[model samples]
Target chain A: MYKVKVYVTLRESVLDPQGKAVQQSLSSLGYQGVEDVRIGKYMELQFDDSVTDVEGTVKEVCEKLLSNPVIEDYRYEIEESAKQ
Target chain B: MKFAVIVFPGSNCDVDMYHAVKDELGEQVDLVWHDADNLDQYDGILLPGGFSYGDYLRSGAIAHMSKVMAAVKKAAEAGKPVLGVCNGFQILLESGLLPGAMLRNKNLKFLCRTVELSVVNNETMFTSLYEKGEKINIPIAHGEGNYYCDEETLAKLQANNQIAFTYASDVNGSLSDIAGITNEKGNVLGMMPHPERAVDNLLGSADGLKLFQSIVKHWRDSHVVKA
Candidate 1:
């Protein structure tokens, strides 16, 4: 079995309004050193042992569905576990 | 002309689109489900707004994968008029039928109100009835309506006059204050404002009615045979 973890974030050039709001709240709470906050999504997917080319599959999924190439970028890590 | 208003799983504006087409424009129209496989019979296509698929993954992201999107693409390729509004616009961007993508509103809040929009280019089939530079009032309701695109795409859009409308003021943090834009071919338009909601004077403004009229006028002109 393969477990894949994906991280999707807005492109650096794009403004992150939600992240900005969070940063503002943090600053108001006395965390003056919180210079920035960029929010993103984290997802996990599991693949059966029958699937081959796990890396290719994960990349395809992330590009096609997990992250929008226009405004966001995505990266993923895969871990394999032997059948119990 | 016949029109199809595609209804996704969470679409709430399908009926509004149907009413605008049927009662306001007095055209034949149908509400097509997202799972439907064909849009060949429709002369024009409308993708209405709402929280499609509950805005999962992202607004319009999942809904763009609906079975009917293939037909929508075919219709677009065939040069049929396609108008996607709000969430519908998001789906268009997600499907790559339109350039750019939407980001969260700069305020990070769901905005719902009428705003003034300047008609940037009235030459397209969708805006032929409106005078160039005319200011129109359209209702906008969405959380993720801040449109974004890279410099190159923005340059291309400007050069091709694909920008259809711009907010009179900065309503959202969209790059270039873009409220709506058309495909390079000019047959498809994706906009954040809800024109359907402003089609009647009773609804606060009838400024949007001319847009529908424009589409019909253009269609009639082209389909008419000249001797």
Candidate 2:
């Protein structure tokens, strides 16, 4: 088994609407100095395959389908998990 | 042309896109789920609209990191045409497949209505069917569809004629009233309107079908007949 984590965010230079909305709400609630806010996502996955090639598999998946290299970016680390 | 429609968890328009591609162009089409990684099989990829992941975190932000996105990136890099509609547009922005980002409608309410879009550029794979300066009505359904970008990037996009579609009227306060944009290479396109939903006259208008037809025609014109 392998555990994987996915992180997705807007490109560094892109503006974030949701994040800006939250920042506006925060300021209305008496917070300050929040120059910018960018929204992102995190996902955790557990794969049942225990093949000898783990990292390469994860990387392949990440590069091929797991993350959109355009606006969102993702990286994953794999660790062997005990089989049930 | 062979086509594939990506179906993320909250993708609502994958079937519509599939039918639009198949019924309109009579092309081979497939529904690719978010978990699949291999997309080298298709000639074109369509990221359909919908509230992926229930619009959690942000529109398209969660879906951007899905496994299928990796395949999307590869297909795009290989110069295959990719189209993103509505939430799919947001995903493209979140995924960095296209520049600019989505923001809440300036009115702070979900806007669902027909919108007028002027064809700013007719040279992209997605907009080739429309004549330059032509105006078409397409329905938009989204809470966060306002597009924002820095001035420098916006200027560059404008200079390159990458702005494919612009709102004829101020709809969501998108910067420069941009409704759709194409990548510099014209292989990737993202628009915040639900073109697939408008492909059939039964649904509303058939104007949207022109987009799919354009993509198919371009592929055939470039690869099959030309070759």
Task: Specify the highest-DockQ model's number.
Answer: 1
Off by over 4 Å in 2: A1-84
Global Cα lDDT for candidate 2: 0.84
Tens-place lDDT digits, model 2, residues A26-78: 88888887777777877787888646787777777665555545345666656
Report per-candidate DockQ.
0.94, 0.10
Q: What TM-score does each of the candidates earn?
A: 0.98, 0.75
At residue B138, candidate 2 shows an lDDT of: 89
Q: Give the root-mean-square deviation of each candidate in angstroms.
A: 1.0, 6.4
Task: Considering the two chains of model 1, state its CAPRI-style docking category.
Answer: high
Q: How much of the real interface does each model capture, measured as fnat? A: 0.94, 0.06
Clashes by residue pair, model 1? none
RMSD of model 1 against the true structure = 1.0
TM-score of chain A of 1: 0.95
